[model samples]
Structure formats: structure tokens, C-alpha cells
Target: MAEITLFAAPGSCSRVATIVLEEIGVPFTYELVRFMKGFHKSPAYKAVNPKGKVPALIVDGEALTENVAILSYLAATYPDGRVLPAASTPMAAARIIADLCFCSATLHPLVTRYCMSVKIGGEEGAAAVKAVGAEAMKENAALIDQRLCEGDWWYGDAWSAMDAYLYWVFGRFNGAGYDLSPYPRWQTHAARMEARPAVQRALAHDEAAQATLSAERMQMGPGGAPKAA
Candidate 1:
């Protein structure tokens, strides 16, 4: 068993990586990177991951960053044939990677803009950036909704890492007060995803990480609300 340790933020995009690990049935541990406390930008975390981002996986001491890269590595290394398609199914594996890439490269950027335009875009231009991001996100949501129309999971019968990834992505949008009801298939998919045993386990892991982060004095919002920014 490789000594896998993940440095991740609690409910952030890193939750996708945590779900992938649980879905693969890997014995990995979370290091509890508290973004609210600036631990991700600390010297220690920066040493582990120069980019100072969540979802950094330290596998037997070698570090891998980025959600797509981490998920791909897990799929290839674990060979679970579930969280992601196994290499034996070459085309399926390739498609999963592409889907992960789309989530990482395409969807995530829009999410960043939609959720953090004030930080990335200037105060004066933040609203405009957020508007554009919201529009683009709707387009992508329709695409995902179409994808979900095929079946409960992205690939129909079986669930993949993409399912967990989308849960975090779309869940974030919903958290930001977006109306996801228009995407009926995706809304149904969300319900099914929440009901999964593996996803429940993953949420437990997230709560554990959250407690650890809290103990470390990570800000629990001004009045005990959630804190990612």
C-alpha cells in the first residue's frame, strides 16, 4: 500500500479528489489544508505543493497537483475500474480523462469566475466578469444536463470520478444561489449522488477534515458560517 496523504480543503473542489479516493477504496489520509487560515499558502504547504492549491496528493512522497492530474493518477495507479475506467478499457479511460480535463480546464475556470470574480476581476469589473461566467456556466450546465439525460451516471450504468467532480462543481453553483431546476436530469443526478453510500463516506471524510481544520484555528466565518474564501 502506497502511503497516500492528501492536502485538501474541506468543501472546496478538493472534495472531488476525496470522493475519488473513497470510491476507489484507497487507504489515503487527508492532511487538512485549511484555506480559510491561509495554510495552503503557508511555507509548509508550498513546500509540498508549490502552487499552494488544494487536491495535492502526496503518494509515497511524490506530489501531484491539479484535480485532473490527481484523478488521472488515481485511476491509473489504483486500476479500480470504477472511479475511472481502467486502462484495459482504453477508449473509456481516455474519455474519462477528457471529461476530467473538461471539468478542470473548462468548467472550473467558469466556476472560479462565477464564485470569485471579485477576487480575480477588479471591483469595478467584477460584476461584468461574473455575468459572463454565469452565462457560460449555464451553457455548460445544459451540456452536463444533456450528458446526464443518457443515464443516471455520466456513462449510463456505472458511476465514474466525473460524477463526484460534477457534484462539487454544480453543488458550488447551487451554493451560490443558482437555480439548477432547469437542468432536470442534473438535478436528479444530484439527488442520486447524495444517496450513494460512497458519497456519504466521502462527506464524512470532509467533515473530519473540516473539524481538523477548525481545531487548527482556521476561520469558521465571522459567526460560525462556512468559510472557503
Candidate 2:
């Protein structure tokens, strides 16, 4: 097997790939892309991923982007690893893909809109955008919470890659002060994800990467000049 390299950013959706990789129990190299510092837009990184997105997986010298595609690839390549649900039938497989698509295409953008309303909407319009995004997020969260209330995992009996994606999204919004108290089932789902060893390891790596970035930023003064200690 060829060497696998994962280009990721801490606290981003890229963490999904890291968690899946950890679950796969395969040897791979992780390269942190400091997205907050605009490292993803650098020429070097742009060469790797023209879209300038995190979670680019380099397998056999070819780069793969997007959570849906990458996660699907991992699941397909390592059937025995069971990174995703082992669909017993064609319709079952489609349902799993549908859930993944719903997360990426619908839920994620709403969260992103709320989190980056200032960028998505002009300064004068940011408040309106955030308000609308929050309402939509709340509705979506409720649906997810209702589904999760039925079982321990999203897909009834087993944990799938969708759980990792949902956990990250829910965790991000919760951290951003979204008042998740109304969604106890969602909270419990996140707690269960936190209890997973692979998730714990991935979170530790994310925290360490974030700390390193924070320390590096602190060393620089307000204008990007080195601070005199």
C-alpha cells in the first residue's frame, strides 16, 4: 500500500477524516493546515487542493476532497474496517448515502452561515442572516435529535461515519453558544461520540494542534511582528 497523507485543519469538518482514519487503524501522516491563518490559500496548499479546502486526502499521489467522497472511499476500500454501515441491500446503502448528503449539503451550510454570517452577509445584513440561519439550524437540530432519541446511533444498531460528521457539527454549534439544552438527545449523542476511543484520540490531536497554533500566534505582536518576551 502507498503512503497516505491527510491535509486537515483542527476543529474543521476535516476532523471527520481523522476520526475515520483512526477507526480504520491504518498508518497515515497528518499535515495540519492552519486555515484560520490563511495557510489553506497559500500557493503550496492550493497546488494540493485548488478549492483550498481542508480534509484533502492524498492516496497513492492522488488527492481526494470533500467529506462525502472521502468517507465513501474509505468505507469502500476497507470493507472489513467497517468505517460506515455495512449495508445489507441496495436501498440500505442509498439510505446511508442520503444521510451523509443531508449532513453535508443541508445541515453543514446552515451552521456555516450562522458561524460566518459576517462574511456571508454584509456587515449591515449579518444580523438578519444569522437570525435566519439560527432558526433553520434549530429546526434541523430538532429533526436530528428526534431521530437520535430512537437509538444509540444514527443508523439504529451501529455507529457510522455520519455520526462523526453530526457530532462535529453539533459540537461546533453548541460551543458557539447555541443553547443546546432543548435537544437532550443530541447532547447524549455527542456524549456517546466523546466516549469512543478513536474520537478521544482525534480530539486530543485537534486540541494539541489548536494549542500550538494559539501559542504561535501569541508569539507575534498585533501587526504580525515578533513580540519581545
By summed lDDT, which 10 consecutive residues of candidate 1 come out lowest? 79-88
RMSD of each: 4.0, 2.5
* Residue-by-residue lDDT tens digits, candidate 1, 1-229: 8999988777788899888888888788877776776888899989988988888999889999998898888877777546675555778667767888999999998889988889888999899988988999888999999988788998888888889989998888888887788899998898898998878898898888777766656557768885565
Best by TM-score: 2
Residues 1-229 of candidate 2 have per-residue lDDT tens digits of 8689999878889888889888887888888898767889999999899999988999989999989999999999988778788889999989888989998999888878887788888898899988888999888999998999779988877888888999989877887788889999889999999999999988877888888887876797779888643
Question: Cα deviation in Å at residue 179, candidate 2?
Answer: 1.4
- List the global CA lDDT of all models: 0.84, 0.87
Spell out the clash pairs found in candidate 2.
none
Worst 10 residues of 2 by lDDT: 220-229
Off by over 4 Å in 1: 87-93, 212-229
Q: Whose lDDT is greatest here?
A: 2
